[model samples]
Target: MQKSLSSLMIALAFASATAPQAHAASNEDVVKRHFASLVAGPTPKTSELQMFLTMMPKGGDLHHHYSGAIYAEQYLEWVDKQGFCVNKTDFRINTAAGAKSASCVSGKDLVADNAAYRALLQKWSTADFYNHSSGKQLPPDQTFFDTFGYFNDVASTNGSEGLQTLKKRAIAENLSYIETIYEIAPITPDGDFDKLAAEGFDNARLNAALEALVPKLEASQAFQQGIQNYLAHLQKASAGVDDEQFTMRYQPFVLRFLPPSMVFSQMLASFKLAKTSPQIVGVNIVGQESLNVSMRDYSLHMQMFKFLKAKYPDVKMALHAGELALGVVPPEGLKFHIQEAVNVAGANRIGHGIDIAHESNALAIMKTMRERRIPVEVNLTSNEFILGVKGPAHPLDLYRKYGVPFVISTDDAGVTRHNLSNEYVLFATRYKTDYAEVKKLSYDSIRYSFLADADKKRLLQQLDSRFSKFEADIARALLPAK
Candidate 1:
């Protein structure tokens, strides 16, 4: 791992040093040169780069997760206030319904017990686990996926407050938009439907089954009621998030680990929401993609996506395909996830196209993405923590080499304990990306977002203005005096 990382670092250093410098339009160009100095050659100044990134005009976080973006600290702040407490041993929050449990510790008292409080924070996030070896750490993948369970109940307890906090943080970083996987649609099992769906992977047969079954699923009162509840939850969570400087949108998703019938039910509901809801911009499928259910039904899920997208042609889609690494799954499993996502499912955008190189037709996939302008949402921190794929071994440069559009994102900032600014720092320094491509990435975020054309134009214009002001201010304030 260390050897591969060194090679990657060397690759970045060479690119930054030898790559043509971005041309400046006029003389008051101190900011551009300053940005270059921090990222070029060996030993790039990561601290200064992070500071510069914080002031940069990032257009949007196109691959954010609602539950994972809000930090555990924020959740803890609401715990005692909401009449909740934490379990001293397991660290799960006791929701109102579970308030009567005597086994749990109050939030206030947990904080008072600094040691346990610190431990809870660790379990809730990736902090300290990387640097230290002990403390009952699960494997990285397990630890990452398990965090949602630890805080799931409290994460959504007060969606409005969480949304506000997310907004304030984004504005502070000068980001103008966020396309978050806020929540998923509800699902109910159809044992009979599952039995039929499980019988085969023949696309025609599955489509026929779905075609026969969806009307009944849609007509059912429980499914309709679930959709109503989802809309209400979204409306409440989205209250007051958008303003003159910031905008937010949702991509209701489905957990792919569920049974075929349930996955289809959820995706159906999510696509329905995407077609009609102004704030719900797209649909996505999310889960640990390496799990048995996810891997076994991988193609099935893609076919499910293919089926729904045809039904709701207006609804946009961004599937989380190929979040795998070698040895984590069988070698064969890595070969076709991203290809099927783009070709079979017709993904508008792909989140964490991490296993791109493993695909049988990797170059062909890149070519298709370039032609279609389908952007891959790259999450440096999340990838590093979850897949241990970073530095030169990461496929970011491969995507760049193929002219494929991509955007930097914070997949689960709260869990990874980093923000978009930090992601930019990682991208810039590791790839030795100069200010110009970095600037283009910022624009790409807005360009690839599943927002309406009008909202995209509005945010793009705002980003342009924000960039001009940010550069001018940095030049005036930080430019070295002659």
Candidate 2:
């Protein structure tokens, strides 16, 4: 009887999943048929197309980093605004003496104001990221990664303004929400930190130095109050943000290369903020995981979380695990990242689980993720940019084949020079997914999002109702006049 009841319950769940569409079947059928009719056509009505795009309910980007979301051009403009000089040959912004050096490339001199130079940088960075050009140099990983240094000055300086810019872009792309990764610290500038440490500092002394810098950090207090400041700033930027517009939340991430205790302490601080700061939803560990220290302490980091979780279980975690591709790490390191994230670190979401196919007990790992419903954050552009994985090489198909929940995300939209819309289009074109499946994927985003239960359900219902109407409208346009 219990087995029979379990079967009945599973059937009921499946039924409920389809029932809403069943009630709205006419509209869905109309869309499916209309799209089918277009297999060999010059496209449908423009207004209808616009509405469809508008109603393409994108779920929240659960794994976005703020610094990676800004447009490269915006950074350049900010650099120019700051009256900084850009190297004529390399385009590196020359900051004030003793300031952090801006990174750029070495090349023949190009007129700084030349439209071609601007376009070249745009092409090199995120602005012209979508343009496919035959003659453009295919960048090495360092060349690509180094772009951040060129713009780091503006990236750090623009802070909230930069976030606002990305937020607007998300809204334009039809994304409904984003959980952006950003750095928050009470620490002094790197130079000051080094200076203090050189002056015979220990951890306690470093803490005192940090406390001294607190006023400096807090002076911007708007940006310096750590996660709380970030929350206030985001709220201010998003104050007029509507339900139809994309919403954003903050995830305070710490560089992993820091001392374990320091990272742990910073992480604890983030968790404390998460408990009270609505905008600050959680914490993430990032940066150069392939480094020896990171790997050496991987288990220790997870154990740290296990300890933190005991104290603050509600503080959410979405981690960067298994982001490495073949040759990126030792063979032994490949098998356990996703597993450790799921089993030990208590990560609710996994970022760039690209090595899923390579892990030991790979199928079991995938099954665990499926059973747990912990979605892998899929950053198609980043995977292609960083790991050389695209199309069939990507795990998109495998994730689907195994029934592992996955959501498309932009890991570093600004850095990779892509957007949420591009990600959708990539999934559609690459996977040969029809519009219904695309719509379903979009809905799945909200359904599986880490939003509060009440909020998630409400957004799911809204997406369903909105999607149904959108399909109906498209169908009405497609049909012959009665």
Candidate 3:
């Protein structure tokens, strides 16, 4: 591992150094440098790769989901150990006898045994996620969302272990921090959809019914106790001396698929938790924002944030906005997500922002973001996988063109099967970025993070020193005989 890493570091050093000059001289020079780095040997270069991989810089994953970022394989492994079955039709895992389903709807058989299940999980996740679209019958979203249930059996009992697994992977990729979203508040087994659907005619009435049910959700000492249980897992996983202290902060995400009132209550409770519990950071409305209720209540949600922002001004807001496409919603809906986030909701950061081109006063919004220093967490892979926005077609270039502050992140790393390095590589190759600019992007991740000012400054200093050493080492190798 160490040897491979060193080689990778050396390869990266050579790649970064030679790439610019070679590209300028001739495109062939660029190709040659790239190839040379690829074949760079393992003894010393592998050590460099190891160093590069293990060099844990203070990272803040601004657009991360706690559940989705954890490996499906790990969860599936746990499920198998617990004796669960993979429902063949949906590809969702269930207790052995409960669902009576098979592998998936596409007719893939469930591998109940450990070894085969592990391999299948790998195929379904980071290992071959970016690669195998050809034979995979699942839609991207379905494939992505489907993993949750497969691992749900194990994850339900393995909270801290799940985070530890996530943190371990993150640290392996040189990330030091994350502010992840999790569903600590459970949606009841008894509070089934049909039961809830039957209670009300519309969202408002549904909310009233849900409010009546709030006592039930809260009454479950199980639900309330789950928060404490999850926190215990965080504390246990994070407890250490020399190891990078993985600071876990939560964003209680309200499902937008629910009626407005239930969703609103969830959001409010999340905001309240942000004030009441140090572990719970803020609130996020997750799921497809392109849905009708989501778009309809967009402004109201912003108003909701406005209320919470007033109550707990210190609480942070990093919302998913402008995750839409031009054709996804009415022309009017595109004009205002990012704007409302800033103007009404007072979001600390914005996620995606892919549809910024269609937004009215987009230029002004970018300018304000630049002036205000509101960082946009850009997940290149998710944009490609979920929304099919990428390359020059992505509004990220526009954000750059207007100098809107941003950072590259893995939105659903486990689902997208990506790491921060891959995200950086994509940005570097696609945008033709410089080392300094890439370093700036890294710095921006921590600098614009929700961490306290002092911590941010300290981490920034650490990043500067580390990047400087990396550059100095690279320059030494590249320098002509002096």
Candidate 4:
């Protein structure tokens, strides 16, 4: 009996030692391994990866800005068509044709001059960031913000055309939706709201002052006509776009550099517009966060949003908070902007939450964000170009580790001379992220989007179908000959 037991034990040990590995490689695993191999070498071409990503189903772009998204070439075309002129000295596009400035060149002449046209492209985008032959080199942060002013008039003139351009670009890139941030122009209010704001930080007086103007502004035929024009532009832009192929929504934003009165009034108008219009989904506050006016009135702006949000609870809010870095603003400035935006203003999604680590009690904020599922819009190229933050210094991994949801985005693809595919490529190459992580980021883009529940479900279903086919194709390619 002892000998028989010993033989059985020996047999069992041998069987355990000889058995194959327990878990087989999943389809995702196989795909990830192939991806790692494809991107293995230093300075890998990644043309194959780019092709794959270009065809890969991207969900939505949530952090886009409409004016900044238009390519500089398109803006130049609009300038030429509008009979505008460009100031050679500063490269500003003047809408009025015959300005009596020595530097002003007619759009026709500028287009004819290849050198000037190329210069305009460089000035209006990050084109000169890497290669600057002449002129003073501006700081990257300043350069990025300054580009907007140069192209503002051209963008204004070509709103619908810009939308059509963006829609076509998005379709070609395989993106399904975009929540673009734009302004409903003629935002100036008849009343002097700035005077009330200059009266110091008195919330009651500001509220009273703005309340008086809301009804007047809402009833203004000009305001109503502006909304109609915006709607018509969208209709015209989306004329032939099939509803199933692509969808878009707008989040009208207020410039934070404006005075408190103007900012508040604009905020009020934005909320009212969102409440009344289906096209405008939410309100956002945008501008250089480090500027004196924006920083000084940061809390005040939050209070205004808080007030308006309470009044119109259904109006969604996405604030551009903590878009600052160390040199951009003093250390103290970084700590509270995101906190106030979240706790005080109740921002549903935080744009460019780059200063999270600098915030006081940041862990608590991360905890709150995780618990509430408050996602951050992560723009990789924009962050690297604007803030000089990337790779380990970036808070992307921190968000993942702490369970805070985030979606990859292109803040201004055209301005940066990049696209969503390039963003995914950077993310994968920089972080060595696996297939599951990459897929989740794409999924989360739509999952955390402000789209209505039914629409979100339908888009998600579309993604599932697309991914299934993608995985199947990948699996078949990876298989060995029978």
Candidate 5:
């Protein structure tokens, strides 16, 4: 039988009440007890706990996407400034007159049309998706992914400016660090390589073909220059920012729906870039996992990682595995994704391991993750919006039950219309998570990050100091009035 939310809350309360009496309560424990009381009340929604969580210092967002993190309104401002046109019919952005095509509205006409502008806002974001009266409701998954395509032009053109915007937003929310997944190299496929990739998935043949391309890629001036340009853009984006207040890192990602040869080449480039660049910390594969090409090449992609990881053992990997739900794919499909990602690809972290219950020998998989200490980047809002998986059905409690570590994040925050604070609110209120658990999650974000050991230690120390101050403030706020 599945556990209900009320039962989960009762279990947590029982655990807290049963603590050993000989030990004195730490500041974190005191804060947790107080917060637990508020949550236990009839209406925790109106309590000050929301304010407390919003102001709390969150350590880092480990699964962010740079382009999808920006608001649609911001993208529109960039569009207007750059003289880009919006297609009134489909609400797509066009870069120039020739690029507008026959179906798109002219830039001047789109600017004058208020109705079209409003439609663009709704179509480009989660603005009107909940309003049944607006006649603009779309399936949540479609709305979430479609936003990226509509705003791709603006996001692609304004890399540095978008970084500045994201930095300012992160500071406002008290976020200490961000590891954003951005595309550094363009996907321009080699014809000879495409023919080889299409030849089928034989490990030996794939290995031989990939080995031949390494020399040519390394020797190409264009490939070398692309890496240089990518690094320069990041440096330009972070020019005057103080690392103490906020820090940023990049993970160059490959689109999973591409042909195997293209995916392998991108992974090769990413690993090479990580070796040479200070800003680029890791590489990840991104896209809808349920796509035909993605599902077909999933195991092949893991093999690719196995091959490359042996070659560049130091390059970090965080694969997006098991983001599917029951209706989205076959039962057999769900059984091995998370397993392969961990056992085959050797992923350091799993993004959106929501289908854990559906995996074959699910308990064994959880046990392996716990023993290995592989963390999951939990994005509550994104999972609910995209997969219709939330509440008691979510694996958040299951991960806790089995001792699997996880850190809360806002995956595509802007697209999902959520922030880090909102994620904390959902987690704490829904799971009845106490303040001590919240603090641990914050610390774990830094602990499980892709940073070097020295940097991780420094960040953890900083977090400890911040939590001490926060606990003191909480004590004063909760005191009885004179």
Candidate 6:
């Protein structure tokens, strides 16, 4: 509905610019002048900027999370459809036995009671965290991650349905592509590897351990079945999602906090899957980077990534590194994440990177990102909410100063209660960016995407057309009558 209205507005602008449609240059000049006017001051017109960015052709969301992109309301609807019951106290998916008891409520019945429904929404998401913070609630970061747990039961169940919602929403906002962290790669545990990892194996020993473990995992029925199940899941989730206008691709990730063997095995499976599946463009490692488990295994995770990259040679990674802040972890922990993610993991892209300022030799890291043309996936809303890093405190300016490329992204739009457009608004307003730089961010999204060379070129050309049309429409709307 909104998208149709926007198109109509753009058409009206086109008409207002000129009837003959021959004054393309004049219309473009008018649009550029108008945009410059909006962005002239130390403080850009934020509300107008929001409207402008909403219609801009954002190339892709490379750091998106499939489950996190889903809103809580949609999950509630699924709960009702799937006949799942919600626990009244914790807002969890209740068991059949528990559902029959007074402790649980049917989704249908819960909706009738408005208070319960609203409370459930808050608990299930970051919705009105302030209103309910008087009660027992987790910290914002904890709350954000916890939302997934509350809905994980039904999260993957309606993959195609969830994907459809995301697609419609993306198109509504004029976004052309999304490469989402769709799901985790399945794993079969390795007892031997686990023992060695806990005892702390050096790099060589770790490699040797993997050498021994690879065949064991390959021969194991459980591991092979995991791969098949993962592929089947992807097939079902992405069925009929693509068309001429928009595209969606998957990034099967491994969680950082898992056992060393589990992480390696999952990474292996995902990298292996990438070798075959065109839909699965890349792999990522994700989780709260500050957790004890995550911090301890950080180096090993990069090594695992490096090993997989060498073996597959074609698999790409956009690792979640430097996602921490000063107080989130010890100083030592901050020093090497982004560095290793780039130098060791051979990450094609970096996600979050909010802690770049605190990283040791931060200039060097930025230099590497710049030199290699590796773009950082900057998630404004996610960083602010999760790490309390925003405005001048953010490392965005540093990256810019050092010439490190970046792409604005939505790390967890549903959890953060913002869209990719809002992210652009935040970034532009915060940095006081002019229209030209803002447009570059849009183009950078496609350029840094893990899509095939052909796909990237195709999308870039589409962006060119989109920007031209958008600028013309805006020009017409801003033109004055004689």
Q: List TM-scores for all candidates, in order.
A: 0.92, 0.75, 0.74, 0.88, 0.88, 0.93
lDDT of each: 0.88, 0.69, 0.67, 0.82, 0.82, 0.87
**How much lDDT does candidate 3 score?**
0.67
Rate residue 201 of model 2 by lDDT. Answer: 48
lDDT pick, better of 2 and 6? 6
TM-score: model 5 vs. ground truth:
0.88
Off by over 4 Å in 3: 1-58, 96-139, 184-248, 476-482
- The residue pairs that clash in candidate 5, if any, are none
lDDT of 1 by residue, 171-251 (tens): 999888999998767896789888986676577788888997799898899999999999998898888989998999998
- Lowest summed lDDT across 10 adjacent residues in model 5 is found at 127-136
Clashing pairs in 4: none
Model 6: CA > 4 A from native: 1-25, 95-102, 130-132
TM-score of model 4 vs. true structure: 0.88
Tens-digit per-residue lDDT, 1-482, candidate 6: 99999999999998887787574567657766777777777778878988988988899999999899998888888887777788877789864643545667777777778888888877777888766566577788998888888988988889999999999999999999999999889888888899998898888998899889899999999999999999998898888889988999999989889899899999989988898799999999999899999998899989988887988988888999999888888788889999999999999999989888878888888888899998889998888888889999998988888999999999989876789999988987788677778888899899999999999999999999999999878877887654
Q: Which stretches of candidate 2 lie over 4 Å from their true place?
A: 1-25, 34-55, 97-112, 115-139, 184-239, 242-244
Task: Please report, as a residue range, the 10-residue window in candidate 4 with the lowest summed lDDT.
Answer: 183-192
Instruction: State, as a TM-score between 0 and 1, how close model 6 is to the true structure.
Output: 0.93
In order of listing, the candidates' clash counts read 1, 1, 27, 0, 0, 0
lDDT of 5 at 337: 92
lDDT of 6 at 291: 92
Q: Which candidate order results from sorting by TM-score in descending order?
A: 6, 1, 5, 4, 2, 3
lDDT leader: 1
User: By descending lDDT, how would the candidates be arranged?
Assistant: 1, 6, 4, 5, 2, 3
